[model samples]
Target chain A: EDQVTQSPEALRLQEGESSSLNCSYTVSGLRGLFWYRQDPGKGPEFLFTLYSAGEEKEKERLKATLTKKESFLHITAPKPEDSATYLCAVSNNAGNMLTFGGGTRLMVKP
Target chain B: DAGITQSPRHKVTETGTPVTLRCHQTENHRYMYWYRQDPGHGLRLIHYSYGVKDTDKGEVSDGYSVSRSKTEDFLLTLESATSSQTSVYFCAIREGQGYGPLHFGNGTRLTVT
Candidate 1:
């Protein structure tokens, strides 16, 4: 079965602290990995899509990197406003549907 | 942000009532998806439409039924609302296949009493 797991269910950090969230997957063939940021009571916002191992994408203070079996979302100097739940999903070569992780809730205290 | 809109942004209904959530897109994207968000569950796919009159179930489609009669509209219906059905529903669209990112609507908050 295809499954996605994210580590550190919740994290609390002070403003300006940097941290990394991990997303691991077990699937037959990896087509793409996606990262999204979702605020409370709102839908997720697209962040990045990594297609292959060693691929990385960055936006603002967030960077997403992918490997053969996992992906990482690194936050640099995060602020209070940057606090949100980060989600990771994977799609197989069949391009059928996305399997999502439980997501990591990040709280940045100012 | 991709011109996607979900109707009945907030709804409260009694159990056993029928409820329908609508998703409309102006981008004319061929791929449209419906998902439900819950605490600690991230987002779970409910149903998706590849094109007009073409739809399929996703990971969590047990109590959900979807219809796509036009290029821009997708509807999700709950035959009988349950307390477990109270959740935030989201709609998404992808322009094409292959590794493109999905654009999501604001979402609909549904509560069952």
Candidate 2:
């Protein structure tokens, strides 16, 4: 079974502070790793997809990087509106289903 | 944003009643998935469909059932609602196979009292 684990279940950061969220996984053969941001009472919003080790993607103030066994989502100078839960998921080469992590809730205060 | 839509944004029902959640997509996506989100569970897939009438169970599929009768509609039904089944259900769609990112609906909040 493919499994994913996220670190620091919850985080509180002040405005303009930067931080990173971690996602560790074990799979038979990783096909893709995904990052998503979900606000309260809302479904997850797609952020980026990292296909292999050394691959990275960026959008707005968020950057995602992948390694052989884990992925990291780096938030640069986060603002108050950046507060949300970040989720990580992996799809194995079998292409069956995505295994998701418990997620890391971020709270950015102004 | 994806064209996915989940009906009955918020529903409150008593235990033992049957509840059905509907997911509709405007764009013809080949993959449709049903996931439930809780406080600490994140998003767990309950079921998914590859095409019309082609469905597969996910990691957590014990209490839920899904059906895809058409290209754009997927239905998830609970035989008998239980308090444990209360969660925010999200419907997601993907245009292609592997590596394609999923687009999700806003989600439906179900409460089984």
Candidate 3:
């Protein structure tokens, strides 16, 4: 069975604080991994997609890195607006859809 | 987001009643999906459509049915609403294939009494 697990169910951070969320997975054949940001009362927004290990993508203060067994979402100098539930998902040979993690709730207090 | 819209942003219905949720997309994406978000469970897929009139069940498809009569419209129907069915449902779309990131709508909150 393919599964995704995210760590640090919830995190509180101060402005300019940096942290990294983890997403570890086990799949038959790894196709891709994705990251999303969902705010309260809204659906998730697409953030990044990592297809292979040692790959990394960044947008503004958010950066996503991937490996054979896990993925990381690093927040650098986060702001209040960056506070939201970050989701990690994986798509592998088992299915054509994404298998999502429980997600990490981040709170950046300004 | 991504030119996708879900109708009935909020709904409250009684048990055993039939309820339907609609999803509209203007991105012309070939792939559309319905998922429910709940505490501790994250997001669980209910169903998805690959194209017009082409739909399939997802991980959690029991008691749920979907239809895509048009390229831009997908409908999810709960044959008989139950208390366990109350949840925030999200609709998503993907423009390409393989590794295309899905774009989601604001979501619809459905409450079953």
Candidate 4:
């Protein structure tokens, strides 16, 4: 079965702290991996999509890197405004439906 | 933010009552999806539509029905609402086929009494 798992269910970081969230997958044929940011009561906002191992994408203070079996979202110099639940999902070559990870709840205290 | 919107952002209904949630998109994307969000579960697919009159069930599709009669609208109907079904519903759309990124709506918070 295809699956995605994220660790550090909840993290509390002070402003300017740098850390990375993990997303490990066991999907056989991965088409893409996605990252999203979701606020408390809103839907997820698209972040980055990594298609292959060694692939990397960035936006502002966030960077995502992918490997054969896992992906990492590294947040640099995070701010309080950057606090949100980060979600990871994978699209398999067999289908368009995305399987999502439970997500990491991040809190960047200023 | 994408041009996706969900109706009845907040709803409270009695158990065993029929309920429907609407998802509207202005981007005219061909792929539309419905999902429910819970505390431990990130997001679970309820149903999805590829085009007008073309829809299919998803992983957690039981007890839910969906219809897409137009390119911009998708509706999820609960035959009879249950307390377990009281969750935040979200609508998403993809701009292209295959592994394209999905844009999501703000979501609908449904409560059953």
Which of the two candidates, 1 or 3, achieves a greater DockQ against the reference?
3
Q: Is candidate 1 or candidate 3 better by TM-score?
A: 3
lDDT per residue for candidate 4 within B56-103, as digits (tens), equals 888899899999999999999999999999999999998687788888
Q: Let me know the DockQ for model 4.
A: 0.78
C-alpha lDDT of residue A51 in model 3: 90
lDDT tens digits, residue span A1-110, model 1: 68999988999999999999999999879988899898887778889999999999999999999989899999999999999989898888777677789999999999
lDDT per residue for candidate 3 within B1-113, as digits (tens), equals 48998999999999999999999998788999999999989999999999999998898999999999999999999999999999999999976865677889999999999
Cα RMSD for candidates in order: 1.2, 1.0, 1.0, 0.9
Candidate 2 to native Cα RMSD, angstroms: 1.0
* Highest-scoring model, DockQ: 4
The TM-scores, one per candidate, come to: 0.96, 0.97, 0.97, 0.98
| Better candidate by TM-score, 2 or 4 | 4
Clashing pairs in 1: none
Native contacts, share recovered per candidate: 0.67, 0.77, 0.72, 0.67
- How displaced is residue B97 in candidate 4, in Å? 1.9
In the range B25-80, model 2's lDDT, one tens digit per residue, is 99999999999988877889999999999999998899999999999999999999
Global Cα lDDT for candidate 1: 0.90
- How far is B27's C-alpha from truth in model 3 (Å)? 1.9
A1-110 per-residue lDDT for model 2 (tens digits): 89999998999999999999999999989999999999987889989989999999999999999999999999999999999999999998877677899999999999
How well is each residue in A7-102 modelled by candidate 3, as lDDT tens digits? Answer: 999999999999999999998898889999999999999999999899999999999999999999999999999999999998887446888999
Off by over 4 Å in 1: none
lDDT of each: 0.90, 0.92, 0.93, 0.92
